[model samples]
Every structure is written in C-alpha cells, then in structure tokens.
Target: MDGLFLLSSYAVKDAILIRPFSLADIQSVMEIQSACYPANLLEEAEHLIAKHQQSPLSCWVATEHQKAIAYLLTHPWSGDTPPALNTPLPPKKPKSDIYFIHDLAVLPSARGLGLAKRLFDTAIDWAKQEKLQKIRLIAIAGAADFWIKQGLSPVNDKTLSHKLDDYGSDTHYLEAAI
Candidate 1:
C-alpha cells in the first residue's frame, strides 16, 4: 500500500487513504460487496476486475488503518442504459459521453465516516478531468435518496426504464451533469 494517495482534508476531519485500487484490493472489495448487497445483487469478482483493468484511473478504494472500508467502481460508458446485474462489461463498446458509477459501497461498520461521499468525489473528479458530460448510475434497492442528495436527478426515459428490468424491482436510473 506504499505510495497510496492520501486525502487528509476530504472534510471528514480524519485521515483516509483514498488510493487507486490495485488488484490486491479485489478480495476486500468482494467482501464489502457481499456485506452491502443481497446475494442476487452481488457481482462476480471477474466482472469487477475487468472494470478495474479497463478504467484504473477511476476505480478507487478507501482504507482506514490499512483496512479497506469502502470502494467506488466506475468507467466510461455510452450512458444509454445501465448494465444488467452480474454482467461483464462488453468488449469494444462505442465511445462514451458519460462516466458510469458502477458501484459504491461502504461497510456498515464504516458508515457515517463520510467515506461514500469522499469516494464519490473521487469519481466526480475523474469525470471532470476526462471532460465527460455527466455521471450516471442505477441506484438499486432503496439507495436512490442517497444519490438524490448527491445531486443526481432521476432519469425518466421509458425505453431506458424497460431495459433495467433485470436490475431489480426497485432499481432507478439517475444522472447528473458534470
């Protein structure tokens, strides 16, 4: 974990190493995923790794005391639709205008540490640097309100809505300008 990026003043008023995710963080990421999501919603580690390999610049893990407590997985995407649950990102995808927030999770024990927002700020910073138009994500379960507080408005496209059937009964598509 040497050379990990440290974000000392993310306004959480505590030290947290928000570092680019290395392959070594996969197991920890999976553990956090399992703790945060239901079995049917958990993504395979391979799919998560492919995303990291594809966009290392935007993928990040947050550690406190050298233990990963949260992570943000993101990548460039067309923004036409959210990927289905457990699906691997397709190869040779077309050019992208949106930066997709594939996953953001913090362990229950780590909640209220402002870790999720710090991790999200990491992704937003990347999207701004890339000059992507907007940030997009499917807020599964009942997490839409948390995202709403982040300034992403709910998307209302019927075509896009139909495609998210596999995401779950409570999934919601949301987006925000960069």
Candidate 2:
C-alpha cells in the first residue's frame, strides 16, 4: 500500500471536544498515552488529575466521540527551586506568568487530524486568558519541526536532563509568547 494513500484517511470526523481534565477521564487519557508513546506514560496522570481537581487551570484533555484522544498539562514557572519529581508544581508568578507544558500526547490513530494543534491552541488560549507571558515546553526528539511550525522557538538555556537521561540529548527546549 502506498504511504500517502494510507495516511490520507486518518482524519477524525467526530467532534473534537477540548475541555478541562477530570479524574473521571484519567483511564482514557492513560490509554491514549500508551497508544502514542513507546514507554508507559501515565506515571504522572494521577498527579495531574489531582492537581487539576485542586486547580482547574492546570490541565486539559481533548476527546473525540467522548473518548480521550489527547491531553496537555501546564504548571506555573515559579522562581523557587523546582519541585522534586512527582511533586505538585508550584503556582505562577504575578508579574511575569509562565506556563510549562509538562506533557502532551495524541493517540497514533488520531494523528494528522489536527488534534495536537487543537490541544496546543487550547493551552495557549488558557495561558493568554490568565495573562501569562510565555508558554514553555520541551519538544521530544522528532517533534522539533512540529513545534517549530506552531511558532515555538528553541531556547538555548538548560534542558530537562533529570526527567529522562536521554532528554538532554534528544529533546530541545522551546518557548512561545502567548
């Protein structure tokens, strides 16, 4: 089968729902993560759910036909020391608010349907609504071009080395003003 022909029918026709994430959607989110990534991806879903439950501004999920297909988690960039792995993220600063997009994934079956862009647009809109000055994220290997096309620019400062050892080598830091 030709690759182009195989890729042309991947578009999702059902309505794409973008909304705040809740505990009820955790399992679906995890399933999408498992389908899209090589490694287990829900280690932080529980934490994200809890944080969102406490503060709805922190996370959002995108669904197609009532099934979670993509999700994004955002956290404030405080000046204090970064929290330990798995700890709840701190709140944003008042003067120069910044949101760090910790995770974003769209199921493989749902790729090329504009789901990722929708998720990104939702996050960027939220940040702007909150008067945030910047949105930052680390583009995993193979995702730099996608992010660049979305107006995210690579930052030369420190990288997310501790999260994934290979992150330093494969990931590029990116940020965009909202």
Candidate 3:
C-alpha cells in the first residue's frame, strides 16, 4: 500500500506551483507577509514590486491553483546600511556581489511542504546567475537550527558590523558562500 486511497478525488500535487512573482501577485505577497511578520517588519507591496521590477529574477512566489501561497525576495547587500523598509537604498557599490534574502514567508496552511526550501533554492539559483559571492539572511527566533541545517553558519554580529538596534534580541545572522 505504497499509495493509499484518499476520500477526495483531487490530487494535492496538481494544486501547487512555484513561479516568478508578477505585478499582479503583489497583494497576495503582502497578505502573506503581513501574516508572517510583525507590523513594523512587514515590507510594503510597492516596495516589493519595485524590487521585482528592478530584478524580477530575484523574486519568486509559490502558488496553489493560481493563488499565491508563499514568496521570497533577495537583493544585493553591501556593508553600509541595512536595507530597511521605505528607507532610501544607498547607491550600489562595486565589489564581489553578495545577496541578502530580504523576505520569505509561507501561508500557515502551506507550511511543512518544503516551500521555504524551494524559495531558498530559487534565491541560490538567482545568486549563481548574478555571480554573487555570498548569500545571507537574518534568522528570527526559533529558526537558527533550521538555517544551520541549510548550511548557513551563524556569524558574529560584530564581524558583519550589523547594528543591534534594528533586530530583536533573538534574531541571529547567518551566511553561506554561494
């Protein structure tokens, strides 16, 4: 009985898809973002759209029957200022490029389905396409082990020159060579 019978006729695999984010998907992305993050932490759809437009290849969405269920957005990060919401992004600096995973979220119903890893794979592929030197993210509380299992090592905040003021005490930084 490798494949068990189900009461419902519909198959789950047919319902889900992961694809690039489009302008029309912004609202759904925002909704998932709001549900996943705190009010102060949620990035606006406009901001996400702008980034998507600038680098559509770096943004992706997981969909189920054409409904957006998850999203992940990545961008280049330099050592200067942290990329804060609605803040003026500093001019791009020249160097071996590094990618910062700015946002990632999955609907509660869609959790435990490997959607997050798929989104992460999308980011890694984008980094390789752009020839980025590294990929990094700030892991929230209860997620350090998850990131560690993904091969991202915990980095000392002082080494990254990250300001502690913006992040909660439980937040930790992780990085991996792309």
Candidate 4:
C-alpha cells in the first residue's frame, strides 16, 4: 500500500469513474490483475473476455483520467458453487438468485483511491437493479478480512467446503445480502 494515494488532493477519489469493460481495455485490465495477484491466480484473458461478452452489464472497469486502473467481474450463478477461476462463463447468462463476483482487482498504486469500494458498490447496485437476491465470492490472496469488513461472511456449510476447495487451501466462500 506504499504508493497508494490516500488523500483526495490526488483527485483519484473524485476523478475515478466506473464503466463497462471494452475489448480495447484488456491489456490495462491484465496489467492491473498482474500487479494485484500472483501469476497462477490471475484470471486468463479468455475467461475475462467471455465473462464480459456474456454479461456486459455485470462486468465493469474503474478508470482514472479515462485509463483502466481496476476492474470487477461478476455473473449469475444458480447454486452455492462459485465458478472455477480462469474458466470462461457460458455464452448466455445463467438463471440464478445469486451474483457471483469472479474478480475485483485494483493496481497497487490505486489501492486507497476508493476504486474497490466503487466497484463493489456497482456490483451491489447492479444486483438490486436486476433483482438478484445476494452476492457471493471466493476470498483469496488473504482477502477474507477485506470482504468481511465489506459485510460478507464466510460460509460454514459442510457441503460447500469441498467445492470451495478448488480455489485453494485458504479460499473462503463469502456471501452478502443485497
């Protein structure tokens, strides 16, 4: 968090905007993901593109001065199982009561600018707008605390423990009411 611009004077707080992702923004999206996550955990481009292509309205990018600095990917899911990372979503949106957050990555330099909160708010607002019941995600990269602070709680269901295992040993399935 060293390079994070915490003060509003940086204007990153006021100037940041969130919009739908475009194919042209892929590289910047990938760069931000690379900076935020390890190589093995970073989502593949195919999966990212497919998610957006499937539910363009559910995927979004946060920008500063019109440059992509962060992104959030989400899709509908029917059951408790979260989709495997790096796997492409189906071409059509799934029928479901849950909105699964597939990814939320902000560059280290942009961490304190409130981009993550903005992207998170966007997801919550979208779910409400679409009449989805709740939001879900697999917490990784030691992000369980962050999600918990955002109002998501860890799933304690015995049945979900195995499906969540695919994410990693520390992976946590979290959900929040809409």
Error at 33, model 3, angstroms: 0.8
Deviation of model 4 at 29, angstroms: 0.9
Q: Check candidate 4 and list the clashing pairs.
A: none
Q: How far is 68's C-alpha from truth in model 1 (Å)?
A: 0.6
Top candidate when judged by lDDT against the true structure: 1
The runs of at least 3 residues in candidate 1 whose Cα sits more than 4 Å from the true structure, single-residue gaps closed, are 1-14, 92-94
Position 141, candidate 3: lDDT: 48
| TM-scores, one per candidate | 0.89, 0.76, 0.82, 0.86
lDDT tens digits, residue span 1-178, model 1? 3334334344245557798999999999999999999888888999999998888899999998778999999999884767776877877366788899999999999999899899998889889988999888999889899999999998888888777877789989999999
Better of 1 and 3 by lDDT: 1
**Candidate 3: tens digits of C-alpha lDDT, residues 1-178:** 3355451324464676678888889899989987787776666667777667656778899998789999987778776335665454455566637788877889888999999998888788878988998777887746778778888996665744455345556777788888
Clash counts for all predictions: 0, 0, 0, 0
Superior candidate under TM-score, 3 versus 4 = 4
Tell me the whole-model lDDT of each prediction, alpha carbons only: 0.87, 0.70, 0.76, 0.83
TM-score, cand. 2 vs. native:
0.76
Among these predictions, the greatest TM-score belongs to: 1
Off by over 4 Å in 3: 1-13, 85-88, 93-96, 159-162
Rank candidates, TM-score, best first. Answer: 1, 4, 3, 2
Per-residue lDDT of 160 in model 3: 43
